[model samples]
Target: MKNQTSITSVLLMSLSDDQETISVLFIFFLLIYLMTVFSNFLIILLVVTCAHLHTPMYFFLGNLAFLDMSCSSVTAPSMLSHLITQHWSMSLSECIIQMFFVIYFAGSEAFLLSSMSYDRYVAICRPLHYSQLMSWGTCAEMASLVWSTPFLLTITYTICLRRLTFCGPNLIQNFFCDLPHLFQISCTDPTINVFILIIVGGTVGIAAFVITFYPYVRIFRAVLRIGTSDGKSKAFSTCTSHLTVVTIFYVSATFIYLVPDTSNLLTLNCVFSVIYTLITPLLNPLIYSLRSKDLKAALSKALHIHRLHPDTATRR
Candidate 1:
């Protein structure tokens, strides 16, 4: 294939080609996007407004809610627009920007999940030192690290991606601009890019996974030693929601990133991408609200207060 320096855009593949099917999908995804944003926003709002929820756990949860909303927003609007207009082409710059945020938010979320797990471990395994270990200052530092570290890594990844030549076919096989898809289509050899992805990305992912789940081992041991059934139940309840969210996020992400990208697996990759990008955000709020009694109680109290003092709520 001859190199074309003027290749400035790429075509994104839509899930369906039929206009009728596209319309149905557009409506379905639009609803999911709206619900995802609203629900996650509500979680953030609840965490911010509820004084009783101003603990380390809720602090990390609020950050997760924000990340979920931001992460979903990175792709949902673009995908919805493509579905509605049946326009699957995006400028190279736009695609690169989207890819940058995708990596940034995803990496940040993995680290944030690890932070949350540490918070739980402290609460369960080191209850006597929970306050000191998970101080507001310490939590702030961890949150800063989670958000900032990924920006650097994503910048490095994007710089490497920018150096690659995309002079050949510019049709991306999936709905969004992901690294693997981009690497696959590069006219130039992507051996360096692949190495960075595997070395840097893999190290971060593995470390985050270890940080996020390894605590559960100690947590389980601690819970087992609790004398009362109620004690064990309460301890497990605190972890169940975070664990569920972590499992879903890591499982989907691992499948998409770790598995070899072959022609036969492109469709499967897209499906898993949808799960991580769209479905996970929608499920996060549901999982937290349904499994977390504190969040439910906080929502109830907020609603009751709103009903009683509509004027006050409006003014605020």
Candidate 2:
């Protein structure tokens, strides 16, 4: 029988047991991590340096890109290291730390996207007040709220979660040590923890989604009523990028939460996690640039900055 005392929450901080799988997966994840980082960094750079992207919409997109970059960075690199090394242990402290950032970044991204959607709605529906209403102060306050609120709540949840004793098997069935996965492996009943997760999570995380989307329902009605064909087209196009991101994140997240945690579904869980965490960041830059002509222009200017001093740029 396995020794009850000899167990840990993190299985693979360094090369895990699955050597062949780890080798292949490590390369794949490394490529994705670099892409996510580069793409998000470029998006943020374009938003900040380019005059055309100084609007509130791109402002929010910039933050989303930042959050996505952070979310992927917090988990993916360490995870890749675990897949390739002999040491596969994340102490309780480390695990909780990872969990905190992951949840915070994830939560912040969600809230920001919802806020962005509301910004789009205001711009398209209430053009007169769009600028005045979504001024620098308002934007900063919203951004602060998004960041600080999620950070505090997730820290509390993670603290409570880490206190649970791990007398059972330590082998985490999935790639990363998620809340549900950890609770599932515990020796005692995780009723209270799971209950808290659903209540706190469903209320805060899911509530943000509801608040964001419900307004869109009304905004779409207004979009349809626009007198000019061009007006309708523009309004719909403005929402396209936000909708794509929201759909991608919410769908994958729902699946991860809705599907009863089961060994049979472990593979599916990992795949869906990749969809939201790894894949979403790459899509954000491409989607924004392609869908919005303004972002494309900003990107052009950003690229042009180097062209202006191509010789000097190369020297440095």
Candidate 3:
């Protein structure tokens, strides 16, 4: 109550209130979190240890894995804790921190997927120059831009958020700290926040979508131009996994955030949030690893090498 005097904390509602349901949800989410962590970590480990995966494509994949892990971490642990204890209290500062990273990682991922698409475009469409275009230095720069742009955007938004006050009821409808829920509870005018969300969020999402899919337009043309069926098949195979990932991610994210957020849609929001936050992270590594024979072979080779020389894997 003392802290409430200054609006220091907000209480979050649980996904479920029934004891049995809570128990089930806790187990389900715990498993999801663990799997996301393990899968992403495995991808990172594979990319780092496998000598064959040192290309720009794999470099972007590694960054994607890291972003997936980070994006999930921003909200999943708190959701897990709330599922067990049903005590979802987060201080103002903590909420802001979570919101910033959630936005940063999620936004970065949107752009990172676009960057990966560029890498693929260069590989498939500009095969001869792929090496020069997607060099390590260029890949590093792309990765830095993908990450740093979102970092700046989120920091700017967070700074704007800090200027607003939260003097009303402090119950966040969702399990995590998201902009919509926070906007619903803000005492100060949220016009600035709404503007930022529209301007920054819309620009990022639209640009990412265009950048990610435009390459595909040319990629499809290039694939069709392949003289041999085998060549076409191979090129399509390389893209299908990425296309699948982009479809799921953009669909779920667009549905969750861009759609109308009415008071009665809390349940819908939570369900959609789970899709993008928890399920998508789990799916990314599986899609990439399962689809890429190169990754599988490298993983097997790395494990074999690790067995023969464990120090080699660790040193990477």
**lDDT tens digits, residue span 1-316, model 2:** 2355735545632333577877888898899899889988988988887877888888898899889898888878777766766466677557667767777888898889888987987887788998899999999999999889898888778777755767656666655666776676676677888788888887997789887798789788998898999988877888888898888888988888788767688677778877877888788877887898887777676568779989888998
lDDT of 3 by residue, 1-316 (tens): 2244457898887787799999998899899989999999999998897788888888889999999998888888988877777887989788888888888888999999999899889999999998799888898899889989988988888888876788768988778888777887887789988998898878877888999999999999999999999999999999989999999999988878877876788678779889989999999999998999999998788678779998876797
TM-score for each model: 0.96, 0.91, 0.93
Residue 27 of model 1 has an lDDT of 88
For each candidate in the order shown, give its overall lDDT on alpha carbons: 0.91, 0.79, 0.87
Model 1 C-alpha lDDT versus the unseen true structure: 0.91
Q: Give the clashing residue pairs of candidate 3, or none.
A: none
Estimate, for each residue in 46-85, the C-alpha lDDT of model 1 and write its tens digit. Answer: 9998899999999998999999999999999999988878
Clashing pairs in 1: none
**Lowest-sum lDDT 10-residue window in model 3:** 1-10
Better structure of 1 and 3 per lDDT: 1
* True-vs-predicted CA distance for residue 92, candidate 2, Å: 3.1
